[model samples]
Target: MTDLQFQCTGVRPEPFGAGPTLLFGLRIEEADHQPVHAIALRCQIRIEPARRQYEPEEVGMLGDLFGEPDRWSSTLKPLQFAHASITVPGFTGTTHVDLPVPCTYDTEVASASYFRALSRGEVPLLLLFSGTVFTGRDGFRAEPIPWHKETSFLMPVDVWRSMIEQYFPHTGWLRIRQDVLEALRRYRSARALPSWEQVFEELLATADAKGGD
Candidate 1:
């Protein structure tokens, strides 16, 4: 059996990724001076909403996710952020690796929505690690890394914001049902709306007029 320790040092956005991606810096250490051949690491990251305070505007935005601030004591639970995997190469005492975490801008996702609601602050995260560890100096031996092996990291909100800004600029993502999308497409075509923004503006104007009436 091997005793292992994990730590999350920092995070940064990866620019050349296919989509939005974040690279988390992780440091792994073996308790004994034993040689480690490699480790197939599986990491589950979670957002601890209750660990930090929220702003007034952010509270309002988060109502959909965690309900009102008054009931947040029970509702502000952990949200699943991402599942990342990596293979740590051989090391004797300590080793460092970059855990690449893929991200989305879709606000429909609980973690993404929670992240978007924050104005300025660090997002508390818990990284749960598991999987197989290969060791033994003479011959290779495989062992299971306990699920209890975990670490916590506070990621700055600006890191997320800057990543999104780099990819989407001032845009946000929305998910809609196929039927609803068809209806919107028809409405746009009928009104000769050149852009989706114009289509939304036209719909908003119509809704406002009806409300006034």
Candidate 2:
């Protein structure tokens, strides 16, 4: 089997996409100088939270994900970021392709919550690759891409923020339970609140008053 090496050159926000998505630039090169017919690839991306330093505010915001800063060494672990798949056309020596990573604003997901808590800096990522490589001098011969094949990259935090902002500018989404949502809707209707933010603020104000008493 010909050895294939993968490199993540850079990442960017894809302007036109079905939803918020990032395009990771990947370079796949063959070491044995054999022509590649095509590659059916599946990439699993993971976030290494412990790989970078976090700001005081960021640490506080990320408490739910990694607990207190002091306990991060134990709490922080690899977080699955996304799963992406793509096919690269035939290439002789090497080829470059775009790997689309779909993103979600829902804080319910660990990866989404982690990204939102970050104020600045890069996010360390591990990319594990798998699938089949179709290559043969005469015709297309199937070869299994090793599961151990992997690469790492530091994704800029701003890129993630930008992609999210483009889809949900100045807004954060919360996936509340259906029952809670119904209660909130009823409360909002009773108070004639124009937005959910207003409802939350009012609830907080009321809670503060009670606490003060």
Candidate 3:
């Protein structure tokens, strides 16, 4: 078995991706100065909400998620953020690699809600790692990645917001049920609406007229 240590150096949003994605820089060091054949890596990221202080407005924005700040001691626990994997190329001593994590804007996701509630500051994160480690000189050997392997990183909230802004740009995403989709389609067809925006704008006007708030 090879003695390996993992460290999360930093994270940044991908300039271009099919969806909002972040690239986390990871460094893997092999003790005893041995050569590594390759590593099959899996990382589970978590948000540590209790690790940082929040501004008054941020606390208000997060009330729905965590309730009043007074109850945060019970509610502000760790939340699973993202799951990512990587295949580390062969290296000796130490090597660095990128772990790409795709993100969602859907408010239904606790991680998404946690991220959106923040106006500024870093998000404390814990990266729990596991997988198979392969190494050898003449013949290859396989070893289970230690369960205790983990690293803590403070990710800048600006990076997450920047990725979403680049991808959405003055837009927001909504997730609705299939029944609601059918209803919306029927309403649009009945009104001969040219686009979903028109359908929504008309609906908003109707709601305003009815004082629906």
Candidate 4:
């Protein structure tokens, strides 16, 4: 595995009447001081909006729009908005990574719903993007990006499989595959058992096993 580090360079908010959309750019670097042959990057977006209060009568607007409130009673509350995971691959060296253009939403509630659904491990919530390596005179320069407007939600196993397939598809990367597969298998098992500390312990055990192997 390559020692990788990333820094968020900029975040710009594009206004859309009431709510704003955010665009994020990152700078990824190799921390090992060695040239990077390839790299895969992943990111998650989180938003927390301030709470607000409304009169019981005026609350009808939110009710008509979002349907029944998740919680309601005496006070009106403000909503939050957040984004799902955004992943991009293929980096030869330090490079500027720009995320796909964001989509606008009418209300914070709508955005928060999408964010919460993704956080809860729903399908069709992660946006995956990739860039291929182009050969140059000396080495390869990572360029020519590919992006998707839509999101791809994969099962936990499928997510591991996809990453393995993308980064190292051959048996020579067996160590990495073993690490990922074992973790996925443990996650699958723990989902049935449902113990938080056990799940975490299993994850650490898998990492240790991979390192030992």
lDDT of 2 by residue, 1-213 (tens): 979999999999999999999999999999987999889999999999889998888988998888878888899999989999999998988889999999998899999999989998999999999999999988768999999999999999999998988888899888988999999999999999999999999999999999999
lDDT at position 172, candidate 2: 88
**For model 1, how does the per-residue alpha-carbon lDDT over 67-131 read when each residue is reduced to its tens digit?**
87889989988999999999999999899899999999998999999999899999999999999
Clashing pairs in 4: 52-78, 124-153
For model 2, the stretches where C-alpha displacement exceeds 4 angstroms are: none
Best of the candidates, lDDT: 1
Q: Which 10-residue span in candidate 4 carries the lowest summed lDDT?
A: 116-125
Give candidate 3's error at residue 116 in angstroms: 1.4
Give the Å shift of residue 202 in candidate 2. 1.5
Question: Each prediction's Cα lDDT score?
Answer: 0.94, 0.93, 0.92, 0.43
Per TM-score, the best of the predicted structures is 1
Q: Write the residue-wise lDDT of candidate 4 on 1-213 in tens digits.
A: 344445555544433323233455667665545455554433443222212333455344546434555555432233322333344554455777665334332224454233322322222223333333333434656543334312322223233233333433442211236787677667768577465456657779889999999
**Could you give candidate 3's per-residue lDDT for residues 11-114 as a string of tens digits?**
89988789999999999999976788999999999999999999988899888788988899999989989999999999999999999999999888889988
Write the number of the candidate with greater lDDT, choosing between 3 and 4. Answer: 3
lDDT of 3 at 41: 98
